[model samples]
Target: MKHLLYLFMLALPVVATAQKDSLAGAVQATRPLPLYRPGFALMLSAGSTGGGVAVGYSVSRSVAVRVGANLFNYDGTLKSGKDTDDIQIGFDYTVKLKNADLMVDLYPFKRSGFRLTGGAYYNINTVTFFGKPTKDVKFNDTVFTIDEVGTLDGKANFNKVAPYVGLGFGNPYTRKRLKFMVDIGFFYQQSPLVTFRTTGMLEPSSDQGSVIQKNLEPLKYYPVVNLGLSYKL
Candidate 1:
């Protein structure tokens, strides 16, 4: 099954590009294969307060891959000023996956030398919750606050693999100097629930599953965006 999945992934580019090249000199027909562009980008996410930075190179005209890290709150409740400050570090793998945009670029503009990029990424999410949430909140004999228990488990662990698309607007005629672009994409992460107890209580009063599920409710993955400036050699 895994082999089949890998094969399917590898075959996509051939299939898409082949179709484009076969038709009446389409966009794929006009563009050169293995066109290369390399650059850096600053990443900001709705998941966390601070942003992340990434640097990488592109080997293809329509597809690129990069690695980056950013501070993100997996749960909606944690995104605010308090809860736990957690950050994620991971690598991303992307495929143009879709080339309709490349076709769009070939027309209306007579520019022959330009690079278009789109792909996906894999992000390994690691989170740390500061202290515990249940130390002060009393819950009968329950030793730990539900929030604290949730943080120890559900909030602190997970991984996310997401796909993204990017469009480039510049003159390849200038020969790799300076180019600016903005990109938007989407991704998601899920953490496993853990159990913990309150300092003052005796019984285990919190469930990580319920707490994490509730906390992450508000954070929806949509339009993961990036704003970048690139220099190609």
Candidate 2:
């Protein structure tokens, strides 16, 4: 009976130690995680602006910044007017979109992916067209050969610095190593400067650049929609 009592006394300390450890673990498990942590991430995206890559840094739970570049180019042919019309023209055109951006994101809610983004883009967007008569063209009552009608070449350029505003979804500081992000926004690029040259009979049309520039006034606000994946680094 004495030995049994000694054994119980010795085992009591070990049992108390085990219970204390178990309680500590339970308290730790129930504790809430931090809302944000600073980190760096890499992102690859595709959207109306084209394909792009960016590097981002989370300054806090509510704010982040990114720097990136995007590019897209298209070359194609366009036909306008009809063969039966006084003039039928075919165009060889190229559209190029290229830009670099510095952006900031603000999150208003804790543990939410929604964010507001504002930024500036170094814009280099252009459209070039070369048009030639596809068939004999009539000027007043006189019909002229394609060679006499000649070709018209023109280019349209936008402002160099554009301001952007938009909203998006994605939080790079989350516990997840990979996250999906999206942005939808618009940037104000101001008016486009149009320039053109004409050869042969089309020389008179060169002065019409102002008219084309006015027609493109609506292009000042460029829309952007991007979908991407971000990997925390």
Best by lDDT: 2
**lDDT (Cα, 0-100) at 134 in candidate 1:** 28
Off by over 4 Å in 1: 1-118, 130-154, 165-176, 190-197, 217-223
lDDT (Cα) of model 2? 0.90
Candidate 2 per-residue lDDT, tens place, 1-233, comes to 99999999999999999999999999998877555757899999999899999999998888899999999998998776676877777989897999999999999998798999999999999989889999887677898999899998899999999999999998877767688999999999999999989898888878878876896688899999999999988
Worst 10 residues of 1 by lDDT: 93-102
Per-residue error (Å), model 1, residue 77: 9.6
Q: Please state the error at residue 77 of candidate 2 in Å.
A: 3.5
Name the runs in model 2 displaced over 4 angstroms. Answer: 1-35, 80-84, 139-142
Which tens-of-lDDT digit does each residue in 82-170 have in candidate 1?
A: 33323211212111111101111211233443444444445444433433342334346544444444333223333345444435444
